[model samples]
Target: MVFYLTNLLALLAVFVILGLSFNLLMGYAGLFSIAHGAFFGLGAYTCGMLMRDAGWGFLLAVVAAFALSGVVGLILGLGSWRVTDIYLVILTLAFQVAVVGLFANLDITGGSGGLVGIPSPSVFGVELASPFRIVGLAWVLCAVVAVIVYYVVRSPYGRVLKTIREDEIAARSLGKRTASAKTGAFVLSSALAGVAGALFAVHLQFISPAEFGLGRSIEVLSLTIIGGLAAYWGPFIGAAVVVIIPQALTFLELPNSLVGALNGMAFSLLVLILLRFRPQGLLGRRSEAPVGDGGGRFAPAEGPEPAPSSAVEVRPASTATVSRDGGAPHSVTAAGAPPIEQPPPGDGATGPQGRKVRTLRCENISIAFDGLQAVSDVTLQLRPQQITGLVGPNGAGKTTLFNVLSGLLSPDEGRVLFGDDDVTNIAFDKRARRGVVRSFQDMRLFEGMSVRDNLLAALTPTAHEWIVPIGLGGGLRRPRAARADRRESADQLIDYLGLHDHGDTLARNLAYAEQKLLMIGRLLATGADCYLLDEPMSGLDQSGRDRVLRLLRDTVEAGATICLVEHSLDVVREACSSVAFLSDGCLIAEGPTEEITGDRELAAMYFGT
Candidate 1:
């Protein structure tokens, strides 16, 4: 009985690690890979071959197995950049099938018969022949993996993965290298799964291609879904239940054929029940479904309750309320100009320590999609420390132009110049690093994270650290200087945006107005020289509009260039120093706000004559 118990525990340990590995991709990175089982088999075969043919030690074999699987994982990760969603699923599935075929047909893999006589692992010439000792080894390794997982998910790097999972476009806009992050995560997951496979090969003394099929992949996937996606104990609970059910069936003395069929059926039934009843799984949070019912409109929840009329509203910090660095706060009176925040020295287009501010120029840029022109030969120059509103009709391609400037989309013709240098070929993330940042009209805050985390993620110095290993200054080594900077910056944005009350709340839970502000705060965290705001005034109440306007004015006054896309002519007339109008993807007029607004033909086209 004890021996049987140890065997079951060992199986549980193996499956637990497998489930966690899969969860790292599916749950954390939101990448549903179908090729995990192939990597597992590769690890097993590599270890088995090393031990049986080359007579390598167990520790060395295990390391080689991990590296072997990781190499394939890195290759696949790079390939995944070209595909996404259902296409990615198909791509991985095809690779997995190919791997199986290779394993079945290759002579080195022992053909279809599979590798046999894989020896049990030994430590220091002492064989772990006892089932209890094997179980102990498996569980210890499982515990180590669990601890690693715990740290990985909670670290800033883990937060970036979650951010990628939530919204890849948003992650890119904020300077995250989504492709590299995804690739790194896949490699790490594959290495861990390889470890599990090596343990399985040693314990079983053999490995068959049949054991690493699509069905096995499905089984591991089920472990995570049935337990939970983002929770630590989810894999253990799922593995425990899955391992025990087959053993329980043995007590019934069923026929071998029936037992195999029943085991598959049992897991299928459990998965179906869990998904139908609790799609978020046992430990995951329940997300509200999008309210898109037939008609193409999303009925998002309404904004937060209105502030009480009697409540004292805190005004935005301005030149009067706060000093630049360490100067006396100026006083304000009725009928005076609103307080504006002074630009920090050594920031924005300006050189470090209050040097000259640089200009960003778009030189006759044009882009098309499938022969349909989106943005046509448009040329514009954004002056230093000015708010230039890009206004046009619905299909004038305002956002497309913004995308070109921010490096989200490359123009088919022409170049973008920052100061004297042409940055037309720069990648989106690099552009962000070079101080060209943007805010989405959708307000793409990393929804599952706190407002503070959303801001912290924009601090590029620590954002890339997610891929580093724990001991090598990954999540384990918290750089006090970098962390302190992020915290200090995040706090300033929180206070500036009046998000102090909701700093700790998940971004998704915030009101729409707050979410929009949070997005602006995230852009602020980047300390960009130029800000491309999609729609700064849409959906905002009078107070909300005022707050955003104040923030924008303050940002510009602080030596940043802003190109805002807005539909509100009143806002453009009131706040913008200049306006650029577009009609049918053509730049019709651009000049002082009054000159653009006073053009009769432009007004007629803008109002749809």
Candidate 2:
């Protein structure tokens, strides 16, 4: 009984590591990969061969396994850049099959019979010959892995992973290289799984392709989902249950065949029950609530009714100017409150220094889908420090032009120039990093995160977003000064947007107007020089629209360029200095706002006369 218990514990430790590593991809990064077991087998085989054939030390072999597995994982991660969801799953499944086939057929891996006689591991020159000794060593490694994972999930790097999982496009719009982040996570996960594989081989003194196949991958995934995803202690709890169930069933008087079937059925039933009643799992909490369901702490509220069309007056671009570095006070007021005092710019804030006045010009751009023109030969320029409005009736291709400018879609003809540099072929994230950021019509905020976190995630200093630096610069804690600066900046923006009271509130729980404010806050956090807003005030009351317009005015006064798509003529006239009108995928008119709005022919087309 003592030996049996020791062996069980050792197995549990090995699987716990696997669960922890796999969660990095499946839970935080939102990657559904079945190739985890293949990585595990690769590690096991690498370690086993190094020890058996090369007579390498256990520690050295484990290191080799980790490196080799990580290299392969890097390849897989790169491939994942082009696929997602079901397609990504299929890609990983194929990788799993290829790996297992190699392991089963390769002579170096002992073919179908499996490798054997892997030497025992030693600690401090003491061979872990007995089950008790091996189990102790296994637990020690498990503890170390647990500590690493704890820090990893709490670091800024971990936040990026969660952001990717929530909304990859939104993350990209904030200048996050999501592909790089995902790849880093995949490599880290694969390396750790390799370590677990090493432990498994050392503990058993043998390994087979059967031990690291699709069944094993599914088992690890099941344990993770059954316990919880993105929960720290979840994998531990799950591994314990998974390891104990089959062992516990072995004591039954039933036949061996019956026991195997019973174990599979029991896990399946448990998973089904969890999916039916507790979809978030035993330890995971629901990340989002249905809008207007009153499930969040700060539910949507009906504020003051829409103000009169003339309530908001157009202000000259030069008035109410504030320092972009937050060094000067702004005259814009929020909710009739006193003018907001600017805090001294922190490291996260962008100032006007080293900035060049550039114009974004789209020259004769055209695009078609299924041979139907969405945007055709439209030439438009957005000058610096001016608010340019793009207005047209529905189906006029206003959004398609926005997509082409933002690099979400490419135009079949024409080029986009920023100043003198052509940026038509740049990736969306790269374009965003170059100071061209956009908002979405649907307000794609990270609903799972708090209002403050949503803003904080937009402040970028790429160094804080990698696994190595995060692990090296004091695990479990972010750099104090940088973190404080980012928080201060985020808090200031939150206050400016009248969301100070809801900083800790989940974004999904905020009312429609508040959510709209949060989206603007996030956009501002990017510190972009050029802004492309899509229907930013669509769902807002007049008061909400006023607040947003005030912020935009302040931003423009600070030397930023703005282009917005607004359907309300009142808003366009109040906020825009210039306008570009489109009709049926063609540019109808472009001029100063008063000139365009005063044109009877254009007005007739705009109002559908």
Candidate 3:
């Protein structure tokens, strides 16, 4: 009985590792890859082959298994980069089936006859053949894995992964290569799964294709989901329950056919019950759930509106000139009035590298969705160091054009020139790195993270700056100096944006206007040269609008370019230096704000002159 208990403990440890590995992708990264079992099989096969056929040592074989599985995971991740949700599920499911078939068919994998004689590992020449010793070894490995996972999730790169999981579009705007992040998650998770496979093979002293199949993958996934997706203790708790409960059933001495069926039925029922009552899992915090606490899906929290007395009104110019160079000094009018705020003294004046990033030229850019043209032959030369408003009626292709410029959508026609370079085909993350950043209409902040973390993540170094350690350590091993610098930057930005009091607050908990401010703070953290803001001033009251307008002017004075898409024409007339009017996928007019706003025909098209 003692020996049986030891073996059971060892098996439980192996499942813990597998559960953690699968959770890294499904829980943390929100990637639902069903090919984890295939990775496990690959590892078992690789380790078994190396040890038995090549006369390799146990440790060497395990390492080889990890590498081989990681390679396959990378390939699969790259292939499924564009697919998501149910489609991604199907894709990975197909890959898993293909791998199992290969294992069953291939002579090298021992065909239908399972590979046997997988040798047990030893530490410092001490044999671990006994069940107790095997259990000890497994627990030690599990402890190490736990430490590694803890540190990785707390690291900067892990923050990026969380952001991607929450909102990939926001992550890309902040210069995170989400596709690469997902691929890295797969590699790490699969490599760890490989480690589990190696342990399993050694413990059982045998391996078969049937042992690592769809059934095993489903079991692992259920373990994670039932425990909690975002909690650290979730996998361990889940694995314990999953491994122990089934083993306990053996005491019942049920019929062989009924045992397997009973186990499967129990798991299915547990999953259904948990999903119905606790969708976020047992250990998950209420805030960690995607939906709100009261069982409603994202019904926003309310807060006090900005007081009327705090508003800073801008003055409209009667005779604003159209100029590429610095504009003439204009005056501010009454507080909280419909007045255009003048470009404080030298708004368009160059600073440091003058005119270097002054213009973003979109030439004949066009895109169609299912034969319906979204943005047709739209062209604009946008100048820097000033706020340029993109104004048009609903469905005028304003946001569509913004998407094209920001690299969210590739145009079928024309080129996007940032100065002399043709950056039309660059990916969204790449475009962001090159100082072209955008904000979404929905304001996609990482709702799961704290407001401070959202700002800090934006300042996290690009992947190139991260130096991998000699071991398989991830971003946590990055240089301390760099991490400290980023943290300092985050603190400074938070204070600058007046979000110091709410620094520790979860982003979703913030009021609507505060959330908008947080997003703008995130944009500032990206250090982008051009800011494409979509409906930034939406949901803001008079004072909030004034604060944002002031922020925009300050940013322009500091030499950053701004292109804003707004529904409020009064705001366009008051805050923008110039305006581009679009009508039905076409640029109807582009010039000084005063010129476009005063045009009778354009006014008729927009507000029925």
Which clashing pairs does model 3 show? Answer: 314-339, 315-339, 315-340, 315-341, 316-339, 316-340, 340-574, 604-609
Best by TM-score: 2
RMSD of each: 5.2, 5.4, 6.4
Ranking by lDDT: 2, 1, 3
Task: Compute each candidate's TM-score over C-alphas.
Answer: 0.88, 0.89, 0.87
- Ranked by TM-score from best down, the candidates are 2, 1, 3
**Backbone clash count, each prediction separately:** 2, 0, 8
Pairs that collide, model 1: 343-558, 346-353
Off by over 4 Å in 2: 287-355, 469-478
Q: What is the C-alpha lDDT profile of model 3 across 496-523, one tens digit per residue?
A: 5545567777888776666777788788
Question: How much is the lDDT of residue 311 in candidate 2?
Answer: 24
Regions more than 4 Å wrong, model 3: 288-356, 366-378, 464-477
Instruction: Give the winner by lDDT.
Output: 2
Model 2, residue 239: what's the lDDT?
93
Local distance difference test scores for all models: 0.77, 0.80, 0.76
